[model samples]
Target: MLKIYRNTSIFIFLVIIGVQWGFYKNYTSEFPNFIGKTNIIHIHGALLMSWLVLLIVQPLLIKTGRTQLHRTIGKVSYVLGPLIIIFLFLIGKGSYWRAIGKVPEHDILRDMVLDSRGLISFAIFWALAMLYRKDAASHMRYMIATGILAIGPGVGRGLINSFGLGIGTALTVTDLIALAIVGFLLGYDIYKKKNYKPFLVVFIVFLIGAFLWQVRDSDTWQSFAKSYASMFY
Candidate 1:
């Protein structure tokens, strides 16, 4: 059963990253519609897609004892990692406003940046993952956390766009699923490793909720976000 679950986890890890990266494998005869005009958006999308592809491939490479190659990619990952942070704020500022209907009452950009619990979660987990690189088990667990953290925006987008739901509620529900994902991983980590000290995970979730609360009542933030969103539209 343990082996089965591990295999299943790897398979899921592949699928989540695979379909996303595949979506932008390049405009071709078999698959097109890879159309976004903004350079920041396109570059960030391609970079992130590469990151996800690396996520899927890294484990296999390690398993086959290609540790040297893995380390070389690790160097690139260090650079791209921060770029992800930058783009998260940049693209997410736009995305959040876009999701919320460009309201006059709130600054979605501020909410996306200052109110960012998800991005912080990714930061913490990715940092820890890098820090624990010498310790494979700890590194793997943190990477899993990072993957879960990375997936929320995609999941949130899919939930609202694909399901015809209200964007606000859809995003909240999407965040909830990410919280659930962390909870499940925490439980699994405990079962597998006999350790339950997921303080980092708890910190991330609390920040997310608190950030949401902070944004809910800011007047200046609302105006700024609305105006920031307007620049593009």
Candidate 2:
């Protein structure tokens, strides 16, 4: 089970990197427009990549018996985690502003709500992981949940960009992927440890998020989003 966890962490990290790269490829031509500017997009990307690197390295450290170094580096997440959420909010706000007049109303609303839900889930799982850091089993489960939450936006983007899927379909695909990952982890816990509490918590939170994502462009949500976006503009 330990070996499975370590290998799965590495696999997830690689998949995240690949999916993000695919998503970015869609915007490669516009990269130069923001190259010199100090933009929220760049900050968000850097912070997220840093977190993903830490996720990959932490597991490898454990696999190789470098617990001291792993613990030392884990301290960085104390700062990194919150910064990621902050930058994510900024990115979402910036995106909303940029699209207000040009993009379709439904598209903007959907994107904003999806981004918000991902950030919320990431924060919840990260806080849980921090609270249970001393319990290696529970801590790692929470951390993996965080990773799953974080990858959702990238998965949606990859689906839209690579497969030319509609926004609704892309988001549905992303949620399904997230649900499958959580289910696999929950099954592992039940099989090996007879403990599914943490995974169950994450799964429930994710399902709620998935539900919200599916209805983000509804009239009620659009009204809420317009009210929220008015604050920044």
Clashing pairs in 1: 106-222, 107-222, 107-225
Please provide, for model 1 over 1-233, each residue's C-alpha lDDT reduced to its tens digit, 9 standing for 90 to 100: 34433553585475475335333333222234445445666776677666666676677667667879978877787887788777766766656645576554344454553335555666777787788788766676676665655455565555555566665665567567656766776777677774455534554654566456456547655565566556633
| Model 1 misplaced stretches (Cα beyond 4 Å) | 1-36, 92-102, 105-115, 198-203, 206-233
Per-candidate TM-scores read: 0.70, 0.89
Question: Which ten residues in a row are the worst by lDDT in model 2?
Answer: 28-37
**Which digits, one per residue and each the tens of the lDDT, describe model 2 over residues 122-228?**
88988999999999878888887877765666777777777889878887887898899889879987998766999999999999988888788789888887887
- Which residue pairs in candidate 2 collide? none
Highest TM-score: give the candidate number. Answer: 2
| Residue 222 lDDT in candidate 1 | 59
